[model samples]
Target: MQIFRQKHLEAVYRRAAEMGPDVARSVELQMLITPKAMGIFKPGIEVIAPVLSTSRKEAKEAVRFIDDSPIRHLASITTPLIPMRTSHMSLVANVTHFPPDVRWCTDNIWIDAPVNNVLPGLKHIADTMPPAPNHSLRLNWQPAASRPDMAFSLESNNYLAVYGAWTRPKYDHKYENWAT
Candidate 1:
């Protein structure tokens, strides 16, 4: 079984290589094989237990934090398994762990990815988005801790952020035909 799984993964890597180096070079592909294949596992199984006492003020404070977090976004989905840090932490060392590169065309492959992935930035944007009231959240601080001090310094030096603007592009009426 183990050998079959390994061969299957290798075939995937070979296919990815045929598409181009970008797919083969992705961090997700690199961590194909390892004991902790998926990522870090947090064991937190909730069960019936005695209720703990809490003050109204404390509860309100907790609520405030909850109202300002990413957990609210996760609750909208069925199963949420977010990783703290992927390649940065070397969680998946071998690039072959990622899906096989299946090319659809010369310019773009079915699973083409940028040589240097920007998924971390995309995830950061999602986490930083303001949460709605009465929603729950869980802040993952691992990335913050590992980030370089220069990143913080840059905020004061050359800060860059979007404000009072729509993150998405305006809808085009010309695409109405495609909606059908």
Candidate 2:
């Protein structure tokens, strides 16, 4: 169990490094030092969750105070509004990292395993993050006219007349039967 926890923690740090410095620090401080660090020792909920922060100072301090600094060099990098990559298949959503921006791509992403043993060449590419806001949440726009035409409406020659024909005539008693 101890060995496994160590391994999982390492992997989490490795993934943070891949996301870029600010992202890595944010993750380490918010998720690693706060929740996952305790989870490693507690029963259940041993998986690491995503790191989230509205402020940069708290993120920096939390990471700095943590016992083990997996990727301390990441603090020197600048932060961007968007994530480095649009598609980080190696990252998993909400599990490995947080605020939905740092997604967890790999399995067992919650465990605190060292990235060296878990991910291939993760250390080499730790700083090679693609970009921020890796994903776009654009609303799907479709022209109203593009909708498929209704078959019933298209087949009817005189829909308006047919609708009125269903009604009975007021004055003609003989035409009552014709209405039916």
- Which residue runs does candidate 2 get wrong by more than 4 Å? 1-63, 66-109, 121-132, 135-180
- Over 1-180, each residue of candidate 2 has an lDDT whose tens digit, in order, gives 011132343444454434323334334222221112222332111222223456666544444423243433323222322333324523543333233322222111122333355344322222222222111111111113334666522221001000001122342343222211
Steric clashes per prediction: 9, 33
User: After TM-score superposition, what is the CA distance of residue 90 in candidate 1 from its true location, in Å?
Assistant: 5.0
Give stretches of model 1 more than 4 Å off.
Answer: 1-4, 24-28, 34-83, 86-180
Candidates' TM-scores?
0.18, 0.20
Cα RMSD of all models vs. native, in order, equals 21.3, 27.0
Which window of ten consecutive residues has the lowest lDDT sum in model 2? 156-165
Query: RMSD, model 1, all Cα superposed?
Result: 21.3
